[model samples]
Target: MTAMPEWMSPPRAEGWYAEDLDHLPEAPRHTELIDGALVFMTSPQRWWHGEVVTALTIALRQQAPEGWLVGREMTIRLDKRNRPEPDLLVTTTAYDPDRTWFAPEDVQLVVEVVSPESAHRDTTVKLRKYADAGIPHYWCIEDQAGAPVVHVYELDVPTGAYAPAGIFREVMKRPVPFEIELDLSTLTP
Candidate 1:
């Protein structure tokens, strides 16, 4: 007998669900696959949260190196068991639809714009997952205390975890190939 694929099985828990990915339905908003779990993305209010994400996206794009692809809400297939749509993803190159999975080799940086509802996951769940996957860089952008701030982490591959790279109230120049342009002052209302 043939083994059944995991996605064919019934969902196992709350806060996540498995998706065929190839045949997945288009979400009304945004969604991600995490540990074979379908994680829904909530729409942000028309305020600081939304504005910050927009600013980062534009800045990263402008600054990114020629071969690097800075994507917003892109569906990255991290592993067969996990897929998460980070707020901003700095990949080595543009995506090829023909591919089936995303490995650490394909990624250079992963950024998460934190919301109150997802504070825990951004710092814990997703952080660990990204680290274990060998993603080299991670950024957690938070807007809870009026001004947006960024916490950066650099992965230690052999250990499969992250170490503090820096914490900044302003956008710092990324050392990679990209050249991002962000004027934080104009990034809000």
Candidate 2:
């Protein structure tokens, strides 16, 4: 077997830290830290995933209030050892050119466009993690016959868990995280 690349080695005995992602210039793009380990998104992105993410980013940006910001494929530093990159995020923080990852508290919503390779993590692991981190909103978008179906959830502050708000297809409208409506059909070509 070929030897592992030097950059692939963990910088600490406990595995990778969230902040370490910034210093590793040679690490692959979209690298994430989960439970103190590096997780790389190596699978080729499906065209549907890319299109939906781009379209959603645009749609969200258009409706975002002055203080809100919409971003795509940005990592959220949930904790010292967990920084998962959601497909899309809506934040209250102002634009910062040098910002690499967002703090969970600053993010109002996170959208994950589910791909086959990420279905389990997106539906289960991340679902739990994002809620535990106190993010107010989470939307997991799944492809149903080439159309995007959004599963929206809101945090139950008392329990520190997510409560299903709605599952939207064709169109999605939400009041919290700012009022916005989206025609899901337009997200895919």
Instruction: Give lDDT for model 1.
Output: 0.70
User: Candidate 1, residues 1-189: lDDT per residue as tens digits?
Assistant: 999565444455443432455565554346667766666656454467778888777777776667877777665566666777677787876668665445667888888888877788788998998898888889898774577777889898678889887777644655643444355555566
lDDT of 2: 0.93
lDDT of 2 by residue, 1-189 (tens): 999999889877999888899999998888888899888887999999999999999998899989899998889999999999999999989899989999999999999999998899899999999999999999999999899999999999999999999999998889998998998999998
Check candidate 2 and list the clashing pairs.
none
Model 2, which residues run further than 4 Å from truth? Answer: none
What overall lDDT goes with each candidate model? 0.70, 0.93
The TM-score, computed over Cα atoms with residue i paired to residue i, of candidate 1 is 0.78
lDDT of 2 at 17: 88
